[model samples]
Target: MSPDTRIHRARVLALSLGGLMALAVAVYMTLGAVGSWSFVLSYRGEKLLTILLVAWAVPVSTVLFHVISRNQILTPSIMGFDALFMLIQTLAVFLIGAATVTQWPPVLVFLGELTAMVAFSTLLFRWLFGRIAQSLELLLLVGIIFGVLFRSVAGLLQRLIDPGEFLVLQDRLFASFSGADPQVLAMSAALVAAASLWAIWRLPAIDAMILGRDGALAVGVPHRRMTAEVFLIVTLLVAAATALVGPITFFGLLVANLAYRLLPGAPLRLTLPLAGLLGALLLVGAQVVLERVLGFTGTVGMVIEFLGGLLFILLLIERAR
Candidate 1:
């Protein structure tokens, strides 16, 4: 396709996705309401904002990860990022007792969790991503292997903890699409926004990183430092998203793969915004339909995961052939 044609297509797709998202938001807020207008909007507005934040952060994180890891099928969750987060949370609860931890200030607890994640992931993922950058199948296999390994280790730790404590851990381990605390939501928004702006400004550097480690450095792109920054942004976004709504395992994979699939050979500038729009639309649209039309609440996470997993499997089969 010609440059002008591609640009026109991208614009059309963006507008379609934006329109769908706006429709979903309207449906979610105003449909079937029975209480005070202020109460209804205030309550649902927070949830909508949280969904939009995840929509932006998860796709950005996944796309940057794919750039560094050079694998679209491998997502932060599949690459054991979620498992690592869970392991850290599990270890903390085991060490400090869930009851005591619950009483601690939310900000302190949140910062501690965020700090530990960034520190650990910076060291571990930098090496792991480097190793898997060249082989797509190997990258996928390694991600699932490490994801299972981390989940197993965390599972062992969780089992050893008190049964009562398991209840607390249970909530943290599963993904939830609703009920994000306002304070945590604010912090996540700030971090995601800052990371996104930095990324857009440094788009040329980021696109260079896509050339692989040696190639990027040959182009004077500071590959090592750029890789670290990418890891930091990915970890921060994934960690924040997981903390907000637990871990939505395949959402990032689903969103990023669809963006690349739809806009093959497109620049990050084009694909990233499309991914964000698709993510928010799939998620929020799912919520509106599930809650309003189907009358099933709290299962948006489940529905999206089911669809995402099917897409992942299909991608694997098609790519393997």
Candidate 2:
């Protein structure tokens, strides 16, 4: 289909996503009044914000990542982002006592994480792409391998830490989405906004990049620089989400594949926006179903991951045939 047709279809998809979001908001409002409006609203509001942030952060990064790499299966999480995040937290506890690490203000911790992720991504891309001409599949394989290395290293370090420190590490790793500092939320929103604006400026280039290396280079696009910039952005976005809500694997894989399948006729202009909206809708809808219908089971992420993994497999098989 032509770009115009894709854009029109994307507009239609956007309308659908907007409708679902509106529905979710209405449901929340009705349920919000069902209990103590003050207490329940305050508590649920934090969760809603986390869901929105993760929703925006993950799919955008993943989609742009695929565009840069020219591969649908490549995701930001596959690049050792979550593993690096966990490694940092584990190393912090191991280096400093658990109390000291835990007592360090969250803002400082956030900054430290942001810095480390930027550095790691810089090194990762510089090395990975700097080598001789490589395929997107090769990049994906390397990323997955590096992610495993990071996870193994982090796990081994965790074993060496004292049991008490391990307890603290576990808390940092698996906390509920119940509380988030308002200040941190504001900072995170600002970062996402800035990155998004940059993304908008680079959108045309991204569309070009999706055509692969030679195609982009032929069109006067600097593929290497764009890849590096996108890698940095993806890492930053993933780190922000991890810092916000611990690592929830497969969320991006699920949503991005769904968006692609459902919106083949949608261009980047429409696909990116619709994908973000669908992500928010899925997460918020799941939160509502889990809390209200399921009586607050602590396995929303696990359930979503399970379903998403299955979806990923089905999509792969469909693509193969």
Candidate 3:
């Protein structure tokens, strides 16, 4: 068979296998008898939603960022997103003591963070992309610089805060799937659905966008306006996921690259669904193995982050060689 045919067959096989594995994991998570199955399922469902939300949001946003930037190495979170998110969290806890912060409803905090992140992206994009000659590389560098600035400010605030507040800030920074809140899940799902609908409506335009800036613009595509819309969509996604489950920094890199390697010839339509499916499978399976099989009570975020980091290094090496 030809190379493309072989690749297509392999991706079809992978998708089938991944889907079955995900189903098995879901069953495993729900099959426990030691605890009240009802209680276990409720908590597990919360975590499942968290994993699924992040699974959907991160890879999609990362893919969009890669397409717009024309660089596989860049993602929305690469642009100081994690730092900005942490800064917001730190500022909140610092300003309102740990006890009070913890007492505040998670839903309110989530909405607030969502508003802040969207506003931040809107302002940044408006100012940066307003100039016709600005390069993505330049924009990326500025993002990194701004991220450093946010981190520095957050660090200073942490140092000045009460010791108890610092402890709360530190605790808040860890990524934890087990602590998923249902209210956050509802909000995240709504936003992701909206973004997905928007993506569907603009499918043809995104296909053209992959042709790079000048090429798309040459073909009469409103490249700048489309990119700005994409950036806003991606920012909303990243913000919701981060605010809900904390930062799964490298998860997008892992899943997106795996999708590229596993998809039926890297077409966005097939690749998007397959990537999302694989991502959900990976997280659900990981959670089951960690919690049920191994009897470990640790968070899923740590495991994904570790594996994702390793995959990232492998990608860098492969690219280098």
Candidate 4:
């Protein structure tokens, strides 16, 4: 197909995805409203906001991560952020006791998690990107190693903690849309917005970086600096979302690859926005189905993980082939 035709088709697909996302939001907010409008609005509004924030954060982080790593299958969670988040939560409970951790202010807990994630990612990425000669293979290997290390430590800590505390930590380890705190919601929105703005400003650099490191360098892009900047932005986005709703292993891969297929050959500007919309659509739509059709028998995260795992395996198979 011609370039113009491809762009036109991409635009149409993006608009269609946006429209469906809007429909999903409407259904989520107004489908089963028997209570007072104000009450329903206030209640569902908080959940919707959390969903939207996560929707934006996850796909953006995933896409930027893919660009930097040049691997469509890799995501922020794969870099050990999710494991690190769990470890931090487990440590908090282990050190302070479950009762104290639960009694602590949500804002304080959120801030502590966010700060720890940012600090950890900053140190990790600096070492990976700055000192390692910018090898993608090295970065991936180190990330996987750190992920295993974090999970092992968390497992040991969980084993040593009281059973009740372990249960509390286990509850917090999985993602949940229903338990999203309003305080964390506000903080996450601000962080996601900041990261979005930075990504927007660097769209040109990102486009160049998509050409790979050597090509970007040949075309005057400062590959090292741009890669670091992308990593920082990805860290903040992933950290905020993970803190808000816990770790989601395959949701990023699902929405990001869907965006790529839906908008084939599209640039980052189009693909990024479309990916965010698709993320929201998939998340909110899944929530709607779980609530309305499945009676909320399971958490949305569980369903997403199941589907995402299948997709991950399929992609691996395809890559091998």
Against the unseen true structure, what C-alpha lDDT does each candidate score? Answer: 0.81, 0.79, 0.79, 0.89
lDDT of 2 by residue, 177-280 (tens): 55777777778878888888888888888788877888989999898788777777777788788777778778888888788888784557777787789889
Flag clash pairs in model 2: none
User: In model 1, which regions exceed 4 Å deviation?
Assistant: 92-98, 125-146, 161-164, 214-218, 294-298
Better candidate by TM-score, 2 or 3 = 3
Q: Cα miss at 144, model 2 (Å)?
A: 2.5
If both were scored by lDDT, which would come out higher, candidate 1 or candidate 4?
4
Give the TM-scores of the predictions, in the order they appear.
0.88, 0.89, 0.90, 0.96
lDDT of 3 by residue, 1-321 (tens): 566785676677666967776686667566565668788777777777778888888988888788788877666777888888889988888887788888888899888878888888777776776674456666777888888999899999988998977887787887777665677788889998898778768777876789888888888889878887788778988988888878888888888888777653455676677667777878778777877777876767788889988987887888899
Model 1: lDDT equals 0.81
Runs in model 4 lying further than 4 Å from the true structure: none
- The candidate scoring highest on TM-score is 4
Instruction: Note the residue pairs that clash in candidate 1.
Output: none
Please give the RMSD of candidate 1 to the true structure: 3.2
Tens-digit per-residue lDDT, 89-179, candidate 4: 9899999999998898888888988999899888877787678655767877888899999999999999999997788888898898876
Weakest ten-residue segment in model 1 by summed lDDT = 131-140
When 1 and 2 are scored with TM-score, the better candidate is 2
Q: Which stretches of candidate 3 lie over 4 Å from their true place?
A: 1-11, 14-18
